[model samples]
Target: MSSAAKRKLYLLKLSPEGNASLLGILQHPDGTVLKQLQPPPRGPREQEFYNKVYDSDCCDRILLELREYLPKYFGVWSPPTAPNDTYLKLEDVTRKFNKPCIMDVKIGQKSYDPYASAEKIQQQVSKYPLMEEIGFLVLGMRVYHVSSDSYETQNQHYGRSLTKETVKDGISKFFHSGYCLRKDVVAASIQKVEKILEWFEGQTQLNFYASSLLFVYEGSCQATTMRLSDVTLAEKRRVPKGLLSGGDVLEYNNNIHVINSTENGKIEASVGKGLSKFYALHKKSCSKRHHSQLSLKVENSEQDNVWKSSTCITQEHLNGNVLPQLEKVFYHMPAEPKESAKVEVRMIDFAHVFPSNTKDEGYIYGLKNLITVLQNILDN
Candidate 1:
């Protein structure tokens, strides 16, 4: 049996303090997550993005550079026992963190796609009117609090209530563990995102709407200071997949339960850089909750971006450093390097993307504003 097949599955469980957006996401001990394709245009659209990027023959310069900001893709998968239930077997972006403080912020002034009806547009606008002004909305968040030995979380409701003046504070809270405000981590995140902005500035291939930047950093201070090594990164993660599966996750709930998965835990074996989480939160309790999966808006149109048919990566990288003075700014290393990533800012949710001949200004505007907000936090 393939090692992936021999492995058991577990629900990717998040702490009650933190909310996850997707439903039916399963994780394995080997640092992979499986997201079931949802119905219709959304499923097809997202699958389409991954397919093109991972297309063995694909060499699009924009995509090649953009792939660095995305999670690794391993192609569509369906368990041998459940062929009818196909899934996108992807890398879990949060796998490396000992205590992952995750945030999903929907970017862009317009959340609705070009195809949105007036009613649909109004519904999105009504939820967060400031989306146009702020260019981003905090959809979900979970931050690890070190001193208290717990996690703190803020959901979409909290995101919508922030005023323009306090938006910086709202963002500051994410970088602040109860113990300290991590300016270093904030700085690193900014640097990473700056790279993404550079790509958007040059590309006219895709317009991203109703998408999110999934930010994650190691919340455990001890882990951050340890000088990460292959040996240290190999240390397991937090909780298993629900339905209860295998993983590096050693603890879950207030109570502690450790399961040392004997499965192949090597990071190298996992395909592509891990993907941002793909889940539509469904609370099955008395409250009975259902939400769109991080607002990756779906489109019914059959049009495809003409940019997909472009050239592949040459040895020198992305048509030879489009901005060399910016410091080899265009080179995209192969995804999933041997050294584990300590912090991440992944651009996720492609269902609402449109073909564009000019830059993705809306997404870029939000990114610039976000950088300013984060920078202020770091300064103060």
Candidate 2:
């Protein structure tokens, strides 16, 4: 069936709540989600990046090494109904990573564009002196703006604004308190980031950088994965709108696997019941004939061997199995018994990447800030 026609059928069968909660509108037979975005300047750029950078044989050595930190790229789709819109079919990270609670954030200054105008250039130079020294700052870190999956909406609940501090705070909270990542994983992730920066600096033909980052937390088996709640760092007022085609629209998808909402006054006691109810509802709703068949294939992304890779730093070389210093106070006491636990932080949103003329100052600035933020989260 045509994509547009499918959407009309979805609207008729799904309830108001179900429609709002739906995150996947065009699930490929292979299980990848098809995201369609309007003709923004960044849309075509993003489509090009996926086609030529990740999937193409541009920089296989470096990109393959850093693949763990990126979303898997399938191909592109151009629906006849929306000629102006660009559709990118990508491996749904949530499904690929086993429905982990995800968080999105922009690392650098959003308003200050170094190359836009003279005033902006001066402002950036004065604002990011340290970034100039680092030699690797991205142009403008825009998570919500470029991604079709992330809708354009004002954040209200978390903080009615989006800024550097808000983004950092959101990231810090997720790493320090929200989920308990192993000390080795944390150290390895930092090393990977540093290596990626070095690779970018060495590149001659193509300069790669990310405006936004995504953190996916694969909670323990016992932990409930709330598939409809990955909130933006700014705590978006409403979930970011997903792919929209005619009457059919895919809602945002997020999994709140770590912390369950408070209920009947006792938060801890309510978790079990809430999980039961969620799963029960999911099974019942999915059993309906109208629903699209959910697809979950065994993912072989670079992350599968991230910990086992010999090139990166090993766990034994770092601190022992005990949690890092920050974990003692911030992390939950007696951390949840996670079976096959995995946590990853990867840079995403490459639509705005442009060749740097004024040295790698902007790119360096963003990278240094991100590394520092991540390190601080790990150490203290």
Give the top-scoring candidate (TM-score).
1
lDDT of 1 by residue, 116-191 (tens): 9999999999999999999998876766654434556566777888889999988888886553466667878888
Q: What tens-digit string does per-residue lDDT give for candidate 2 at 51-72?
A: 6657656666744654656667
Candidate 2 Cα errors over 4 Å, as ranges = 1-26, 55-69, 79-85, 109-170, 176-185, 204-210, 221-341, 357-359
lDDT of 1 at 292: 18
- Candidate 2 TM-score, true structure as reference: 0.47
Please report, as a residue range, the 10-residue window in candidate 2 with the lowest summed lDDT: 4-13
lDDT of each: 0.61, 0.40
lDDT for model 1 comes to: 0.61
